[model samples]
Target: MPGSFHGRLFPQNTIHLVHSSYSLHWLSQVPKGLVAESDLPLNKGNIYIAKTSPPSVHEAYLTQFQKDFTNFLSMRSQEIVDCGSLVLTFICKNDEEDGCDFWELLGITMNDMVIEGLIAEDKLAKFNLPLYAPSIKEIKQIIGKGGSFKLLHLETFKLKRDSNMAEKEEATLFDEKSRAAYIAGNMRAVQEPILVEHFGEEIMDELFERYGKKAIEYMKNYGKGIINNVVISLSKTN
Candidate 1:
């Protein structure tokens, strides 16, 4: 059965099966510290879209995430009489000591933008995109603390991109006009509030146009690929 929480929809407790795939990575809300600046190019006055502030903020967010998630499990663990399981799939980097590769790349790009005056320096300084790729050890700690659950299985894998597609495949497939539209859509995901904060709406649009073109060219030249790891399955021990 499905239910609602605070006018937001969710599955009710009657749901014997609880499965989450690629969804847990989204923190309940964007980190608060990162959205304080309203006039910056990337700030956009929207907390959800602004970049995170200070690397420590990421840790603080994750600690709260784990605590809330544990409480959720504690509340629901007793509902299942025979067997209950929680499955999570999230994007994590191979290195546990440093940040994930995705964020590292974004950080590099963001820094370059800042230096070029495309984004505000203060915004960049406060910017810390969330990258909570907990180590295998850390995952174990979370599981142990959260619930009385037995570890059934755990695995890690890489995410790869297709090589066949051109840098601007949609443009090539359709026409120049269509290509422009396709690029706009793709850039929206990458641009948005971050660009808005640094450059405001007008300049951000121009920057996205320029950066999007270059990014496509880079992808076309250097094959597309991503390296991501995952932890698979766990069972309730109680």
Candidate 2:
């Protein structure tokens, strides 16, 4: 995001309303401390922060998110007019996914690929998704500490990510094969740019292709992913 404020991207105190959904979870850049001074990767077997990750890796990610979100609020607050509103929607960490966590399944799939030599361990270590799902309390704390805006309303809801696909007629049901293709296509549209930039073109096709097949298997075994989506409306008082 470049932390642009009152500059070319956004002029100060001119914008009235801003809307964002499911995007703020993404960090402006990859979290640091993923690699040690020895140039060895700090987070070695998984993609994003995984359940088995060391405490340091977890702390590193949390620190990065705090820094990024604080800066984001600071920047945008300057561009907002008095009483201008910012409505943000984001995913959170919760047990609302039944027993299936999409991120965990994705991590397992990536780790499986590493085990099978489909992708190198170092590559996995080198790559960390620039994403962090903050809890609702953490979100409120960051906003409160930002000091430029006052939160007006907050709501959280959980829903199956692909429930409609399952509710369709048997003939129209999303089978593993069809579901894999669709999931890959949809996610690739959004993630491919950053992925390619990080992992390059050679790994892009193969990685997502493998991921899609694994994702289908995961869906069959665990149903769809569930998420706690939070919406927060805040007003700039200063």
Candidate 3:
């Protein structure tokens, strides 16, 4: 189930339970802008990539995320029985080199959209996306600061294509087309906002058509067979 943390709407300790998957990275606030003043274009490329390029605007968001997440945990920590667990999975970059390249790709794409005037130049220029992939050490620090949890199991693995296959492996459940659609769908969530901003309603239809085709081709040709997966299981110690 999804939970929300508005920082004020819900009282502290009013209820008890939290579960999240691939959701923590989506911060509540919009990222810092990235568009330059001089180069606004229309019908641009991927804007998210451009908007988040950085020394990590995502990092800035994490500061707030940490505060909120910690508060959430603090509230829950008081209620959970000792040994209760909190399990989470989030996207992360294990290698700095790989992480840098990945964010750069996203940033450059958004910059292109800005050049095309698909999104507001000022919006792009000021946009700053979060770039947080906490290491085990970092997680430990957070847990320590929160002061109520103990780490139980920590593991990181890569999710591969074959991992999606069933034991018998007679045939993959999702066909190539289906797989492409799935990947493209996820990409669209990040791309849609940029497209809308840059092209407006007039060009959005065509923009999506282009985005869909390119995303499919890119996934087929370049997507890694694997993605990094981090699993952390925490228990209330106090």
Candidate 4:
């Protein structure tokens, strides 16, 4: 209905089934604490929760996710008929500390810009993604406490980073730089809007160009990666 899912977009008991893919991980907005008025940025020098992020920064993100996701469930419960089903698939965090490799790499690329006088350091410090990848345990608890749904099934799976290129002839033709550009292009499609909003469009090409190089370096050091995804089936309860 062209509205935020954080709020009800459907009438009570009107929907028989709902399906969402790769979307729930995006929170409605950035956590308030991270963007709160302050002399110093809360999550300085990085976007998203990084290895260097303070514990409070991590807590703020998790708290925001809890609030937003609970709202999502409550809103959907109102719209869905009794025992109506919800199927969702989205990125999720596993036991690994840094589940967002591309994001981290983007942050590194931005920081490199900061060092080269391409963008202001403070501007970089103040930016963060309005996204979170919850653990399965975290999701289960939230659904349980909400008391509006029964979890029918849940599973997590991984897809290789280059899975998109598997069938393409370009996969065989790509050199290191081509492969890196391909990966960076995918990230750019998702991130360009917010980045342009904050940094302006002047740097878009330069930004992704540098990002491609960083992606190649990252793969050389860490090997090609995998994206983690979680799929869940839920039924509304009376």
- Residue range 13-39, candidate 2, lDDT tens digits: 888998877878888778888888999
For candidate 2, give the lDDT of residue 63.
86
Runs of candidate 4 exceeding 4 Å displacement: 35-38, 97-100
Q: Rate the local accuracy (lDDT) of all candidates.
A: 0.52, 0.76, 0.53, 0.87
**All predictions: root-mean-square deviation over Cα?**
6.7, 3.0, 5.6, 1.7
RMSD of 4: 1.7
Backbone clashes in model 2, listed as residue pairs: none
Order the numbered candidates by TM-score, best leading: 4, 2, 3, 1
Separate clash counts for every candidate: 10, 0, 28, 0
Q: Is candidate 2 or candidate 3 better by TM-score?
A: 2
Clashing pairs in 1: 40-197, 41-196, 41-197, 41-198, 41-199, 42-194, 42-197, 42-198, 43-197, 52-128
Which residue ranges in model 3 land beyond 4 Å of their true spot? 1-18, 31-59, 99-107, 129-132, 160-181, 189-226
Better of 3 and 4 by lDDT: 4
Q: Rank the candidates by lDDT, best first.
A: 4, 2, 3, 1
Better of 2 and 3 by lDDT: 2
**Lowest lDDT block of 10, candidate 4:** 94-103
TM-score of each: 0.60, 0.85, 0.64, 0.94
